[model samples]
Target: MSKSKILGSTLIIAGTTIGAGMLALPLASAGIGFSTSLLIMAVLWAVMAYTALIMIELHQHADSSATLHTLAKQILGKKGKWLASFAMLFLFYSLCAAYIAGGGAQFGDRLAQWFGVEVSATQGVVIFTMLVAGVVTIGTSTVDKVNRLLFTLKLIAMASVLMFLAPNVTQSYLLSMPLQQGLIVASIPVIFTSFGFHGSIPAIVRYLDGDTPSLRKAIVIGSAIPLIIYVFWQVVTLGVVNQSTLLENQGLSALIGTLSSTVSESNLAGTIGIFADLALLTSFLGVSLGLFEFLGDTLKKNSANRSQALNRSITGLITFLPPMCFALFYPQGFIMALGYAAIALAILAIFLPIVMVSKTRKLTTDVAYRVKGGHIGLATCFTCGVVIVCAQLLISAGVLPALG
Candidate 1:
C-alpha cells in the first residue's frame, strides 16, 4: 500500500474511536476528576493498542480477507465463531444507537436554532438515519470519502473550541478530587469505550494488504491520535467546567447547553456545537459502514440470488432500523448505549484477542510479528477485560454508582 492509503486507513481508525464517546468523557469522568481520568485513559489505550497488534498478528497467519468471524471459526471453533458474531453485532448496534440518539438531538437543535423550525427528537432520528444510511449503502469508498471530509472538519472545530476555551481553565478545578467513591470504577467501562477502534482492525488489515509493518504502524499511530486528542480534551473540558456543573448536565443535550451558557465567548459556543455535531457524524459513518458490510455479507450467504444493489438496500435497513427505533424512544440513551458498547468491546477487543492469540501461537509457529509479555501479558489483559465487564454490570445492577 502507498503512504496515502496508509494515512487514510489511519484516519478511519482515529475517526471511529473519537466520536460520540468523546462527548461522554467529561460527563462520565466528572465524578472521578481530571487526574484519575487521565490515568484510566492511558491504561486502556495501552491495553487496546496491544490487542489491536494481536489482531494484526493473527491476520499474518490467516488470509487478508479474514474477518473476526473467519478467524474465530478457524482458530477457536464453532462456539468461538458464534460468540464473536454476537459480540460484533452487539457492539456495533449499541454504538449505532448511541450516535443516532446523540446525533439526532444535535441535528434537531441545529435546525431549530438556524431555521426557527421545531423538529421533534423522533423526527430528527429519522432524518439523521436516512442521510447517513444513503452514504453507507453506496459502499466503503463513499463512506471513506465522506468520513475524511467530516473528520477534517471535526479536527478544525475541535482545535477552535480548545483555543477559545483555554483561557477559562481553572487550576483549582483541575486539581479537584473524586466526588464520591466507586465513581472511578463506574467510569472504567466508558473510558474503555473511548479507545474502541478494534472493529476496524480486519478492515485495516485488508486495506493494507496485510502488510505486517504497515499494519502495525497504522494501528499504533491511528489509536494514538485519539488518545492524545482525548487527554487534551479532558484537560480542557474538566478544567473549564467543575464537577458540580458536569454532574448537573445529565445528557448530551444538557451538557452542550450548559457549555454554551457557561462560556462568555458567543462564537466559542457555536464552534463547540459544530465540533460536537461533526464528531457524532464522522463516528456514525465509520460505525454504520462496518455494520452495513457485516449485515450485507450475512444476508448474501442466505440469499445468494439477490442482486448486489438490492442486497445492499436490505442491509442498510437492517443496520439502521432497530437502532433508530431505540433512539427515538430513548433519546437520552447516548451515555447508556456507550456503557453497553464497552461490554461488547471488551469481548471483541480484549477477550477474543487474548484467547485467539494464545490458541494460534500454540497451534502454529508461522507468526512473523508477535505481541510481547507472553502468557503474563495475555492473562493481565484478560483480567482487565473481565473487570470492565463486571463494572458495567455492577453499575447497571445498582451495586456501583453511575455517572450523572
Candidate 2:
C-alpha cells in the first residue's frame, strides 16, 4: 500500500473511533480521577488495538471481500454468524441512539443560544435525525465526502479548545482522588466504547488489500491517534473543570454547559461548544451511515425483489426510528446509550475477534499475519470484554457506583 492509502485508512480508523462517546469521558472518569482514567484508557486502547490486528489475521484466512459476518460463518460456523449479526445490530443501534440523544440536546441548546428559539428535546431529535437521515439517504459517497470535511473541522475545533483551555488548568484538579472508587467500574463501559473502530477493520483490510505491514501499521497508528487525543482531552477537561462540576453536569448538554460556564474566556467557551457540537455531528454521521447501510443490505437480502426506492424508505425508517424515539423519550440518555453500546461492542469487537482468531489458529497455521501473545493475549482480551459487560450490568443493578 502506498503512503496515501495508508494515511486514508489510518484516518478512517481514527475518525470511526473518536466520536460523541468522548464527550461523556470526563463525566464517566470524574469519579475515578485523571490518573485512573488515563490508566484505564491505555489498557482498553491496547486491548482494542490488539483485537483489531486479530481481526486482520482472521481476514487473511478468508476472502478479501469477507466481512465479519462471513468470517464468523466460515470459521466459527452458523451459530457464530448469528451471534455476530445480533451483536452488530445491537452495537449500531445503541450508538445511533447515543448520538441522537447527544446531538439533539446540542442542537436544541444551539438553537436557543443562537436564534433564541426554544426547541424541545423531541423537536431537536426530529430535526437532528431528519438532517442526518437525509444525508445517509443520499448514500455513502456523499456521506464519506461530508464526513471528511466535518472530521477536519472537528480536529481544528478540538485543537482550538485544547489550546484555549490549557492556561486555565489547575494542578489540584488533575491531582484529585476519586470521590468513590467503585464508580471506576461504571466508567469501563463508556471508556471501552470510545475505542470502537473495530467495525472498520474489515473495510480497512480490503482498502489496504490485506498487506499485513500496512494493516498492522494502520491498526496501531490509527488507534493510537484516538488514544493520544483522549489523553489530551482528559488532561484539559479534568485539569480545568472541578470534579464536583463534572459530577453535577451529567448529560452531554450539561457537560457542554459546564465547559462553557467554567471557563472565563468567552471565545474559549464558544469554541468549546462548537467542538462539542462537531463531535456529536461527526459521530452521528459515521454511526448512522453504518446503520443505514447495514439495514439496506439486510432488506435486500430478505426482499431482493423490492424496488430500490421502497427498500431505501424501509431502510431509512428502520435506521432512524427506534433511536429517534429513544432520544425523544430519554433526552438525557447520551451516556446511558453509550454504556449499552459498550456491552454490545465488547461482544462484537472483543469477544468475537478473539474467538474467531483462536478458531482460525487451531484450524490452520498458514497465515500472512498473526497478532502476538498467543492464547494468553486472547484470554486477556476476552477478560476485558467480560469486565466491560459486567460493569454495565453491575451499574444497572446498583452494585457499582454510577456517578462520576
Candidate 3:
C-alpha cells in the first residue's frame, strides 16, 4: 500500500470506529471514573489490536478473494459460517438502528430548537431514514464520498470540542478513583463500543491489494487513532462533567450541555450537536453500504443471474426496514442498543478471526506477519471471547450500568 492508500484506509477505519459512540464515551467512562476508565480503555485497545492483527493474518492466509463469510466457512465450516453470518447481520442491523435512532433524536432536537415546532423523535427518525435510503438508492460510490466528507467533518467537530473544553479540565478529575461495584462490568460496553471496526476489515484488507504488510499497518494504525481519540475524549469529559450529572443524564447531548454550561460560549454546545448528527449519519450510511454489499454478494452467488430485481429489493429491505422501525419506536434507546451490537460485532470481527487462523494453520506460512507469543496470543484471543460472552450476558441481564 502506498502512503496515500494507507491514509485513505486509516480514515475509513477511524471514521467507522468513531461514530455516535464517541459522543457517549464521557458518560460511559464516568461510572468507572476517569483513571480507571483510561486504564480499561488501554487494555481493551491492546486486546482489540491483537485480535485485529490476528484477523489480518487470517485474511492473508485464506483465499484473498474470499469475503468474511467465506473466510469463516473455510475455518469453522458451514456451522461457523452460519454463526458468523448471523452474528454479523445482527450486529450491523442493530448498529444501523442505533444510528438511525440517534440521528433522529439529534435532528428532532435541533429542529425543534430552531423552528419552534413540536416534532416528535419518531417523526425525526422517519425523515432521516428516508433521506439516507434515498441517497443510498442512488449509488454506493456516492455513499463512499459522503463517508470521507463526514469523516473530515467529524474530526473537525471533535477537535473543536476538545480544544474548547480542555481549559475547563482540573487535575482532581483525572486522578479520581473509580467506584467499586459493577465498574468492571460497566466498562465492557464502553470498550466494546470504542473498539468497533471489525465490520470493515475485509474490505480494508482487499483495498490494500491484499498485501499482508499493508493490511497489518492499516489495522494497527487505523485502530490506534480511534483508541487515542476515545481516551482523550474520556479525559476531557471526566474533567468537565461530574458523576451526578452523568448518572442523571445518561446521554451524550446532556453531558455536552452540562459541560458547555461551564464554558463561556453556548456555540460550542450547538457545534457539537450538529457534528454528532453528521457523525451518526456517516456511520449509518457506511454500515448500511457494507450490509448492502454483503447481501448483494450473497444473493448473486446463491441465485444466479435471474434474481437482480429480487436481490436489490431484498437487500434494500433488509438494510432499511428493521433500523427504520427501531429508529421510530426506540429512538431514546439507541446508545444501549449500539452497545449490544458492538458486543456482537466484537465476536465476529475479533474472535472469529482467531478461530479461523487457528483452524487454517496449514495455510499460514513462515513468512506471514504472525502474532507474537504464538500460543499466548491464541490464549489471549480465547480469553477475550469468554470475556465478551460474559459481558453480553451481564448486559442482557441489566446488571451493567446504562451509560449513553
Candidate 4:
C-alpha cells in the first residue's frame, strides 16, 4: 500500500469520475438552489462512495483478472453477463456522446475566438471526434501518459477560474437561487452521473495489484477530489453567472453558452474555454479507456501475456462510433445524454454492487474488506438506485422538465 501507488490509482479514478458529466453541474444544480444542490451532491457522494467500496470489496475477493462482466457471471451466471454487458455498453456510449458533444461545442467556440472562423455544431463534432477517436485508438498506455499531463493543465486553468470569480462574489448570488420544489429530483440523476467512479474500479484494483487496503484508500481519496472540486466549481460558477440564466438554459450547451455572454472580460471567457477543452479531453481519455478496456475484457480480447494481446481495431470503431452518432445528431443534449447514462450506470454501478457483495458474503464468507451497515445500508443503496433510475426515465419520458 505505497503512497505513490495510491496517488496514481486515485488520479485514475478521479480522472474517470470528473469528466463530461461535470460540464453541466453549475447549470444543472444552479436552479436547485446552491444550498439545496450541495445537499443533494453530498448525499449522492456518500451513496456513490459506498457503492464504489462495495465494488472494490467484490473485486478484491474475486479472481485476479475478473472484471464486472466476469465477476457478474461468476456470481449470477450467463444472465448476469448479458445484463451487465448491456448496462456497461450503454452507459459508456451515452457518456461518450455527452463528452463529444460538449467537446465540439468548446472546439467551435475556441475556433471562433482564435481564428475568427465559425463552425456548425455538426462540423465541430466531426472535427473533435476525429481528434479524440485518434487518441483513444492509440491504446491505454498512451492515454495514461497523455491524461496525466492534461490533468495538470486542467487544474491550473480551473484554479484561475475560482480565483478570478471569487473576488466578485456577492452574498446575493450565493443566496439568490430559486429553488423549484418539484424540480429538485432532476438533480439526482446529474449527481449520480457526476460521481460515477465505479467504471474504473477494475483499473484501480489492477493498478494496485488488488491490494484491498490500497484499493479502499484510492476509492475514498479519488472520490473526494472531485467532490471538493465540484463544490468550489459550483460556487464560482454560481457567483459568475446569474441564477436566473440557468433556469432558462438547462442544457449544458445553452448553460455554458450563457457563461460567455454574461462574463464581460475576455480573459474570463478565454480561461473558461481553455479549461473546458482540457477538462473534456482528459475526461474523454479516462472514461473512454475504461469503457474500451471493459469491452476488451468482456470480448475476451486481453491477455496476461504480451504476445497474446489481441489488437482488434474493430473494437475501437464499436466503442467510438455510437457516441459520434449521438454527437453528430444530438450535439446540444449534453445534459440529456448524461441523464440517460445515469439510468444505465445506476443499474451497473449501484444495484449490481449490492447484489454481488451479498452473494459474495453468503458464498465465501471471506474477504479483506466488507461494506458496513449490513442489509440496511444495502437496502438504502438499492432504494436510492431505483429512485435515480426512475427519475431519469421520467425526465426522458417528458413527465418532467427535460433539464437538458
Candidate 5:
C-alpha cells in the first residue's frame, strides 16, 4: 500500500482506540496504581493488536468485500453469523451511546462558553449525532478522508494542550497516592476498553486492498499511538493533580475547567473541548463504518449492489438510532455505557478471535500471517477474556464497585 493509504489506515485504528475511553482514563486511574494501569494497557494493546491480525489473516484469503458478516458465515456458519452480527451491533450501539454522551457534553460546554449561552446535554447529543449521521451515511471513503483530517486536528489540539500545561507544572505537582486494594484488579475491564481497535480491521482490509504487510504494520502502529498517548496522559494527570480532585469530578471536563483558568488570555477550555470533539468524531466515523458495513454485508447490500445508497441508509439508522435515543434521554450515561461496552468486548474482541482463529487456522492460505503459538495463544487469550468477563460480572452483581 502507498504511504498515504497506510497513514489513513493507521489513523482509523488509532482514532478508534483513543476516544471516549481515553476521556475517562484519568478518572479511571485515580485509585489504581498508574504503573499498573500502564502495564495493563500494554498487555491489552498486544492482545488487541494480535486479535486484529487474526481478523486480517482471515480477511486476506476471503473476498475483498468480506467483513465480520462474511467471516463469521464462512468460519462458523449461519448460527455463528447470528451470534457475531448481534454481538457486533450491540457493542457498537453501546459505544455510540457513550460517544454521543461524551461528545454532546463537550460540544455543549464549549458552545456555551463561546456564546454565553447554556446548551443542554440533550441538545448537544442531537447536534453531534445529526452532524455525525451526515458523515456516516455518506459511506467509508468519506469517513476515511474526514477521520484522517480529524486525526491530524486531534494531535494538534493535544499538542497545544500539553504545551499550555508545560509552564504550569511544578515539582510540587507530582505526588503518588497509595493504591487502594482491589482497585487495580477492578480497573482491568475499563482499561481493556481503551485498547479496542479490532472492529476497524475489515475497513483496513478494504482500504489497503488486502495488503498483508501494511495491515499488520497498521494495527501495530495504530495501536501504539494510543498506548503512548495514554501513558503520557496518565502521567500528566496523576502527577499534575490529586486523586481527590478526580474523585470530585465525574469527567475530564472538570480537569480541563481547572486548567482553563491557569491561562488568562487563552480559552483553554475551548481548546481542550476541540480535542475531545475530534476524538469523538473520529471514533464515531470508525464504529459507524464497521456497524453499517457489517449489516449491509449481512443483508447482501454492499457497495457493489444497485441499491447501495438505500442500503447504507438502512444500515446507518440501525446502527445509529438506539445510541441516539440513549444519548438524548440519558445524556450523563457516558461512563456507564463504556463499562457495559468493556463487558461486551470480552466476547467480541477477545473470545471470538480465539475461536475464529482456531477453527479457521487450517483453512487459511499459508500466504497470510498466522497468529503465533497456535492453540497456545488462543488458550491464553480465552482465559484472559474469561477473567475480564468475570470481573465485569462482579461489577454488575455489585461484588466490585464500578470505576469511572
Candidate 6:
C-alpha cells in the first residue's frame, strides 16, 4: 500500500476506535485494579488483531467493489445478509446515539464550567445530536473531510496533554492496583469497546487495492496503534486520579475533572475535554458514514428509485433518535450500553474472520498470510470471542456485576 493509503486506513481505524469510549475506559477499569485491567486489554488486542487478519482473508474472496452488505450476501447468503445488515445497523446507530448523548453531556459540562451556565444534560445531548445529524445528512464527502481535520486536531491535542502530564504520573501509582473483583468483568465491555474497529474492515480491505498482504499488514498495524494508545492513556489516567475517585465518579469525564482538581490545573482538564470531544466527533462521524454507506448501498440495490434524500433522512433518524432518547432519560447508561455493543462486535469479528479463512481459497494457490497455529489458532480465537460475549451477556443481564 502507498503511504497515503496506509495513512487513511490508520486514520479510519483510529478514528473509529477512539470515540466516546476513551473517556469512560479508566473509570470502568477502576474497579478491576490496574493490572487485571491491563491484562484484559492485552487479551482484547490480540483477539481483535486476529479478527482483523481473518477479515482480510474474507475480503480476498469478496468482490473488491462490494460493500459489507453485498459481502454478507455473497459469504452467508440472503439470510446472512439480512442478519449482518441488521447487526451492523443496530451496532452503529446505537453507538452514534451513545456518542451524541455522551459527547453532548461531556461537552456541555465543560462549556458550563467555562461559561458559568446551567444547561441541562438532555438539552446538551439534543444540541449535539442535531449537529451530528446536520453534518452527516449533507454528504459523505463533507463528513470525510471533517473527519480528517478532526482526526489531525485530536491527535495533536491528545499528544500535547499526554506529553505535559507524562512527568506527573508517579511510579508508585503506575505499580499500584485497585482492590476489586467484578471490576475486570464489568470492564470487559469498555475494553472491547476500545477495540471497536471491525466496522472498518471492509473499507480497509478495499483501500488496500484488494492486495491481501497489504490489507493484512494494514489491519494489524492499524489496530495495534489504538490498543497501545488506550493502554498508555489508562496508565496515565490511573496515575493521575485516585482509584477511589474514579470509582466514585464512574465516568471518564468525571475522572478528568477529579484529575484536574488533584493536579490543580484547570487548563489540563480543559485540554483533555477538548481532545476527547474531538476524538468522539471523528469516531461518530466515521461510524455514521460507514453505516450510511451500507444502508445507501442496500437500499439502492433492493429498491427502484434509490431516493438518496429519503435514505439520508431515514438513516439520520435511525442513527440519531434512540440514543437521544436514552440520553434524555438515561444519559449515564451510554457508556455501559457501548461496552455491551463492543462485546457483540468482538463476537462478529472473531466468527466472520475464521469462517471466511476456512471457506475461501487463494486465487493463485499462494496464501499471503496464514494462521501459524492453523486449527489451534482458529479455536483459540473462537473460544476467546465466545467467552467475552458470554461474560458480557452475563454482566448485562444483571446476573453478574461487570467488575465482579
Candidate that scores best on TM-score: 2
In TM-score terms, candidate 5 sits at 0.84
**lDDT (10s digit) by residue, model 2, range 1-404:** 69999999999899888888788889889888899999999999999999888888888888888999999999888999999999999998998998888888888888999999998778988998999999998889999899889889989999988888778889899998877768878898999889999888888888998899998998899999999999999999999888887888777767777777767555567888888888989888888888888878878988878888888888999999999999888888888888998988999889898888877788899775777899899999899999999999988888987643
Summarize candidate 6's per-residue lDDT along 1-404 as a digit string, tens digits. Answer: 58788777876776667766777777677766667778888888888887777676666665776666676678767876777667776677667766765688786886688888778877788888788778988988888788778888888989876776666776666666657455556677667777878877777777777877667667777888878888778777877766666668865466666666654663565677777788778877877777666666656666566476777787677667776787687677667667657655764677666765666543334665565667888889888777777777878788767531
For residues 1-404, write the lDDT of model 5, one tens digit per residue: 69999999998788778876787777667776466677778887878887787788777558867877678888888977887777877788888888887777787887787887787777877887878888878867888889878888888988887776656554443445436756666777778888887777887898899888888888889999989988877766665566676666656467566555555467664666677678777777777676776577766633555586677777778777889899788776776677778877877787776777777766654754675777777777788788777877788788876766
Write one digit per residue (lDDT tens) for candidate 4, span 55-143.
87888667767888888998888988888989988887888888888888888877887999999878888888877767777777788
User: lDDT: which candidate is best?
Assistant: 1
Clashes of 5: 0
TM-score of each: 0.93, 0.96, 0.91, 0.90, 0.84, 0.90
lDDT of 6: 0.72
RMSD of 2: 1.5
Better lDDT candidate (2, 5): 2
Cα deviation at 353, candidate 3, in Å, is 1.4
lDDT for every model?
0.88, 0.87, 0.75, 0.79, 0.75, 0.72
Which candidate, 5 or 6, has the higher lDDT? 5
TM-score of 2: 0.96
Off by over 4 Å in 3: 264-266, 299-314, 362-367
What local lDDT score does residue 339 receive in model 3, on the 0 to 100 scale? 71
RMSD of each: 2.1, 1.5, 2.5, 3.2, 3.7, 2.9
Q: Candidate 4 clashing pairs?
A: 251-404
- Deviation in angstroms for 200 in model 4? 1.7
Steric clash count of candidate 2:
1
Can you give the lDDT of residue 46 in candidate 4?
A: 90
lDDT of 6 at 252: 49
Off by over 4 Å in 5: 1-8, 134-149, 166-178, 206-211, 261-269, 289-318, 362-368
